[model samples]
Target: MTIVFISDDAQALACGADAVAAAFEKAGCTVERVSSWGMFWLEPLVEIGGLGYGPVRVEDVEGILTRHAELVSASTPHPSSSATIEAWTLERQSPTVKQVQGDDLCVGSLEHHPFIARQQRHSFARAGKTRPLSLVDYTATGGWTGLDRARSMAPADVVAEVTASGLRGRGGAGFPAGIKWKTVLEAKGTTKYIVCNADEGDSATFADRMMMEGDPFHLLEGMAIAAHAVGAGEGYVYVRSEYPHAIAKLNAAIALAAEKLAPFRVEVRVGAGAYVCGEETSLLNSIEGKRAEVRAKPPLPALEGLFGCPTVVNNVLTLAAIPHIMAEGGASRYAELGMGRSKGTMPIQLAGNIKHGGLFETAFGITLNELIHDIGGGTASGRPVKAVQVGGPLGAYIHPDQFDLPFDYEAYSVADALIGHGGITVFDDSADMGAMARFAFEFCAAESCGKCTPCRIGSTRGVELIDRILGSGKTAPDSVEALPQMHNARKAGRSRDEEFQLLEDLCETMQFGSLCALGGFTPYPVRSALKHWPEDFGQAGSAQ
Candidate 1:
């Protein structure tokens, strides 16, 4: 009996994996629904005897099975009467698998695929290999070893191990994870909480959702280790309501792992789809059944959080890396992987207009040029890469000239950019920087929690001001003749120079005056576009 594996990941399902699976099942083939390999472009991917076939349709199933049957009959010394299938399996698992391309039916083994082969997966090592809810599969792959290791040691010893690992938060802020855990552990509280921020609202980021859906046990184990270190009895995963599939899988995994977790129980909390809830305070508030809004930070969540008790709020990826770190010598091994202050592997999601958009986990020193061109395979449109957004919507728009910049937290900060959540969104030459700049302000305006005036008012006013500047012929020249006539009498003839100044002033105000990152970081894209592509704003010399 030939076994077939198809992805049940949300992206795969959206691309019609369910139909493909049903087609295989109807043909009397042994079918198993597995997690996505994150090779989204070739979704509805099916694997047979270690060979990968993708973008498969219901119509293609018969042809695939027929090809396998032919391979089975032709090969010599076949265990299941399939010599060719055995050869392919050996090739996939072997050190040197034949790398072939341009064949729609077979891309060979995904292990040898350039996209999968090059990545140094740590937190996502078990991503595509196991059944998400299978305890047998999870343990066979060394799942609970980390938790067992953490449980044997003292709580402080567990904290020391994590601190030695040099792991940083993967959720935008590059704060050291061990330090946060230490604070929670040392904080004066009897009941502490571990909150996993899974409210992944970023446009190009899906690693969190993938982790929860693919390897839910990995996340649970990581959280349990954190619980042991911080002396917390309860944990909550605040996932956005938009990720129904991830939420469902997490809930199911929690049920299955109830005994494994013991006193350190886990719960799944759903967000109301508010983008601001991605922030720590907002997420904590949402878990408490309060309105999802950012609370001013003085008493950080590590000391005062979750019903006025001490708490450790780490994102999905941050917690997910814990299991690996807790294994023997895993901390030192993880600490040695990356460059400079940034340590361990980052599960960077390559998205937007890219040829191979998926999760690529590697050390932090890889350059944007290597990621975009060498790894990402350049633009999906096959056009010259114009700009790439290294973070989420709030991240700065990086120009082609800056492609050589290393993908490190401190390096990006010095460059006036950030590797926020490791979500890279690419854009081609056809992208309009002016329109993109306007969209940034518009995004801020629409998603603002409205608790602070700078973000709420500044973003709305930014949209109107950019509209006026765009209409004032700023893209061509600053001359009065080039400017369009205003419809309002109050401001009949405002110069483009004045509007530009107003925009600059507004950006400055938002950057400094805003309470949270929503108001503060909105100026990143706006200013980066204005600085790098001043001609887009029609003011070539106006970038400051």
Candidate 2:
């Protein structure tokens, strides 16, 4: 009399729900749709009588019914309680979830895991552990307590508390979150907005998606708190289209939260698969139904943002952390957990060629070496770890020698890198640094909004220069002559020069003149490669 449908795609499930319910009625059972249990290979999995049946193709319904009838009469190997099945379903896909469930020893309980448990998590504590859409579950775990507290306090006091937390924007800029909120609060606009930039385009990072999928209410709670503090009644979460799961969960959570916390409505805006939209200004443009492009920053997003109103734009994690800051104590308490100027726990994303590819939340003192070897457990391919790219696409490529470097902004900056979004992408010995460096420029070129000439043209020139240096044609003599010319060309002031020099000049222009981090910091990875991986650049134009 009970039927359950599971799908990796929510829209697919929603679309098929009625058809499935009709089939269930024909068979005298009620049907319900649920999110995938993470075993994507067997999608549209159907459960009846405590047994899972799938890769459940639409044409295989009759087969499933026959199989179920047989299973009813015979003993099934996969028999388990519904609760256990649901628990297994949820835990199977995420290592972070498995860690929370004690399936992985190194990660331990998600709440007590060293990576996630050691530091304060006011916003993320209940994310993976709670029912994302249930208001009762959210409230039971101290959800709206921060909003209630903020409602009682003066807006200035809320801003002061955020400032005290020393929480910086998690959207790669490292700007102070409280300062941003204060700017919106003090701006002379009758209407203000709280924008949650969930357009996480970085392939190596999944913190926002995971947070949205596992604990959507925390993000909503954080946004609600921001609205209360900044006097903004309306908020929007601009999420990337690639994360359909995250979008669906966020939408459902918003609806549930709207019903639960009436009068405060949070809407979600979907992005059109543009990586540049991750940039705040570009995101604002996209939200306004314009082309996703970067804008000049003199006005700053705080002073003039979405719809030309004063707005507070923050990363999903940054806003999610606000509730914890309010609920637990103050900014100083959260700030005390990390090292140096980096005053909070960072949810580090371990991905790309690594054995342990998952989210690791820890204080900002852990070394890159520890992250890759001790925590990540080295390359999945059993190859020697060659290079590590920290932050996101715009972050620098760091060598093993720099692995001892701490995980803080200033520390990374001193090393010509930035801990952007705390993403750590590992590359084994087979990875080509020269190629990666070229890809960095290529990526910039592709994602650049064309608002600045430096990023638009420089990225194109960088790829060509790298190809000229590494391409397999020139001889030793060409190599010897090309090196000094390339170096001098870099030093020269003219934009028209050797391709390498032109690329360098482009980097400088972008760094100094570009509107936002997207164009400004594309040079970080490119320059870092030129500095650290000279061998990959080869002896100028020497043949491979």
Candidate 3:
């Protein structure tokens, strides 16, 4: 009997992977639903024997199986001869096996695929490999070892190992994970909490969702280890409502691992899809059944969080890395991978108008030039690459001229950019930087929790100013013509230039005056766009 592995990931499901799996099952193939390979473009990906075929449809399944059968007959030690699917997978990795590309479909081993081959996967090591809920598969591939090792050591030693790993929070803030863990562990509180911030509201970021759906047990193991280290008896995973699939998977994983994660009970809390809830304080507020708004920070969440007690709030990726850090000798190996300060691998999500878009996990020193042109395969439209947003919507718009910049936090900070959530949204040459700037402000206005004045008021004003500057304002063109007296008086006025200055001033106020990063970082995109493409703002191309 032929063995088939089909992705049951949400993306795959949306693209008709279920039907394809059903088709294989009907055809007498033993179908195993597994996690996505992260090669999203090839969603609904199906593995027959050891070769991969994707974007496969129910209609195409019969033809694909026939072709595979023909190939197996010609090749020695055929898939049918192999004892099991795992053995078949390992055998097909031989150099003698070659990828076959047809006009109808592309057949190949994912291991040698350019994108998969180039990546140095750590967090996503089991991405395409494991049956997500299968504890046997999890253990076979080195899961729960971190928790076992963590359980063996003193709680303080676990914190020390994480600190030594040099792992920073992947959740845009870039705070040291070990430091946060240490503070939570050392805080004077009998009852501590572990909160996983799964509210991934940023545009073009799905790594968190993917992790939760694909390898939930790993996340659970990590959280359980953190619970052991911090003496926390309870935990919560705060996920956004947009990801029902992830939430479902997590709840299922928690229920399944009840015995393994004794004493540290985790509950899944759903957010109302507020982007502000992605903030640590706001996430805590949401978890506490309060309005999801940013909280003032004198009492940091580590010291006073989650029902006014000590809490460890970590991002999905941050907590997921804990297991890796706790594994024997994993910290030293992980620390040795990246460039200065930024140690360990980063699961950079390549998104937007790019070819071969997916999760590319590698060390921190990879340049944008390499990522965009080499790894990403450039713009999907085949147009000239223009600006690439390195972070999220609030991240600065980096021009292609700066493509040589390394994927490091400090380097991005120096360049007035941020490695926010490791989301790189590529844009082609046709993109309007000024319009993009306006959208940034508009996004802030729509998402602000309304606790702060600058973000709430400044963003509304920013939209109006940008519209006038871009010649889209209501009275912009006809103000001089419609009113003769006003036109005469304002003839000597540098109205456009003044508007630019006012916009800059508003950005400055929002940057400093806002209570949180929601307002503080909104200016990053606006300023970067103005600096790189001044012509878009009705001025010559001069750096501001």
lDDT of each: 0.87, 0.72, 0.87
Per-residue lDDT tens digits for candidate 1, residues 1-544, read 6678788889999999999999999998777677888998889899776567878999999998876555434442222324233343454565423433325587766777788889999999876666788787788778999999999999999999999999999999989999999999999979999999999998999999999999999999999999999999999999999999999999999999999999999999999879999999988998999987889998899999999899999999999999999999999999999999999999999999999889999988999999999989999999999999988999999999998998899999999998989999999999989999999999999999999999999999899888887784324333554446733224245677778888899999999999898899999999999999888877768556
For 123-210, candidate 3 gives per-residue lDDT tens digits of: 8888877788888788778888999999999999999999999999999989999899999999998999999999998887889988
| TM-scores of the models, in the order given | 0.93, 0.77, 0.94
Candidate 2 colliding pairs: 100-110, 122-324, 164-331, 165-331
Candidate 2 lDDT: 0.72
Give candidate 3 misplaced runs (Cα > 4 Å): 80-104, 475-494
**For candidate 2, which ten residues in a row score worst on lDDT?**
101-110
**Predictions: Cα RMSD each:** 4.5, 7.8, 3.3
Task: Choose the strongest candidate by TM-score.
Answer: 3
